[model samples]
Target: VKRFVHISVTNPDIDSPFAYFKGKAIMEQTLIGSGLSYAIIRPTLIFGKEDILINNIAWILKRFPVYAVFGDGEYRVQPVYAGDLAKLAVELSKTSENIICDAVGPETYTFRRLVTLIKNRVGSSAKIVNTNPKMAFLISKILNLLVRDVVVTREEIYGLMADTIVSNEKPRCSTSFSNWLEKNADLLGTNYVSELNRHFKKINEDAGYRISG
Candidate 1:
């Protein structure tokens, strides 16, 4: 709350890379206790052309031509554009309001549908196959133990699947996913895939191509 324009995700009570919920809860606690003027924004799965994580996932899925859909891919989400969120943040900083608003795209889509949208935008020949939570959990456990990467743990998956569509109580500018995609289709296509490959190469090198016993 200190200065204002305090935007954060709706974190869980527990700690996890899925810690977004917990983290946001703490932030809200701080804001409430701080007694400073503030505006809070909780955005759901913000995406953009140069997004490092979410967009990277989309790009990677496009390149592989095959994707694993965890938990029926029926989870619904409202993806927000990074630019729109950024604008809201700026507005919050300049305006005076002690309110929390959910910043999200106009459309609500299922996880499977999201993949389809990406495929359409990128023109990727990828096939998204339904996957089980057990498999995802196994992969998550391995990654966490081997690489200390908790980005794909069960808790994180829960957030993606079970979390409610962020509320826009305060009301702000809204941007549809289609419009965002139309504006950045090229970036979502081959360009992103190429960049992702280079990124993967660097990651592979940093992790040491192969770990020896």
Candidate 2:
């Protein structure tokens, strides 16, 4: 039996920060209609080694403290670790059935707190501020118009309000954020330029691969 497992988030609505989430919801809907044994896992804000979003944001905020929050910094989030989510996905893959699971961290933290952790990591005494959704929307709209990219918007802030706290359901595995941080402490604030260079070097060693630039 082939089981299709999906890792999704709480907000798949159009008013999401990332347009990709709505696409994910569409995929999930299509899968359900396709009569296949599948499992959908909606994980919360995931933070771990090599995490693009959480880690990058933390790095930026820690280094540059001029970032503003969407609201009053009261929104709660359950930041899961990537490794834990992978373990659960693997376990689910072993079975062939349609199941919807919400993967989340053990603790609920506010958006401000999340940034604070990053601030501490980067050793940048950056301060976090709060802003209204409308103001954010205006700023983002103007910026998008000028820069040809919508970096931040109101709908995105609304989406953030839809926290990913796992309801009263048993998580297949539980990896606390602190534990994840501890285990991946070495990768907390490293530049990783060497890692990228190593990847290119390996690629160059492959047959018929050439760097034309």
Candidate 3:
């Protein structure tokens, strides 16, 4: 490709303790080395219609008594709406400069605040509790088993433990998470939607492609 638009995470560090962050760093490095005129769009948590993170958060809030926040739950998360992320990617595709842009949203919420937001939106009485990282991982596993869906992943738990996902750069997306949730409140968490199910469904539905995995 003559030009590349890579969607990555905000400030991924290769040396970070979390594999998710390290993996994003590796992808960005690989893209930079490919000699393509590239613009990397790093977005924080993304919320939108039928989304994974936000919807799943609602699922847990609606069903559970207590929602676990990893560590002290002070990490700041900046969510960019999916439509905004796509709009940024499209705009970057026409550019030839090698640059990195963060497609964050207008609002920044702490990890605990994010969970609380979902809890409030879902009209749930679940209490937000702080759990140690190791304990959080184990609890996530147990929840996944009980729900028969991925309530949370260890990678996600580790990533959320990051200090902050905010960006000083001007946000590419202007949609507010709070407003979006308010608009889509009724449909956020109707049922279990597996990420793998979403992934393979698209692959299997392709016109001339098949994914065995």
Identify the candidate with maximal TM-score. 3
Local accuracy of candidate 3 as per-residue lDDT tens digits, 33-111: 9888999989888888878878878888888789888999988888899998998899889977899988899998888
Instruction: Give lDDT for model 1.
Output: 0.68
Candidate 3 residue pairs in clash (backbone atoms < 3 Å): none
- RMSD in Å for candidate 1, one decimal? 5.6
Q: lDDT by residue for model 2 over 1-213, one digit each (tens)?
A: 466788877555544456667777787788788888898888877776666556545544544547677778777877887888898889888887678888877876787787676666556576777877788667657644543444544555776765534345555557877666655654654541232333464687586564332
* Model 3 worst lDDT window (10 residues): 204-213
Which is superior by lDDT, 2 or 3? 3
Regions of candidate 1 where Cα sits further than 4 Å from its true position: 11-18, 137-151, 168-171, 189-213
TM-score of each: 0.74, 0.71, 0.88
RMSD of 2: 6.0
Per-residue error for 116 in candidate 2, Å, reads 1.7
lDDT of 2 at 190: 52
**Candidate 2, superposed: residue stretches over 4 Å from native:** 11-21, 134-154, 164-168, 182-186, 189-213
Which pairs clash (backbone N, Cα, C closer than 3 Å) in model 1? Answer: 10-21, 11-20, 11-21, 11-22, 12-21, 12-22, 16-19
Evaluate residue 125 in candidate 3 and report its C-alpha lDDT on the 0 to 100 scale: 95
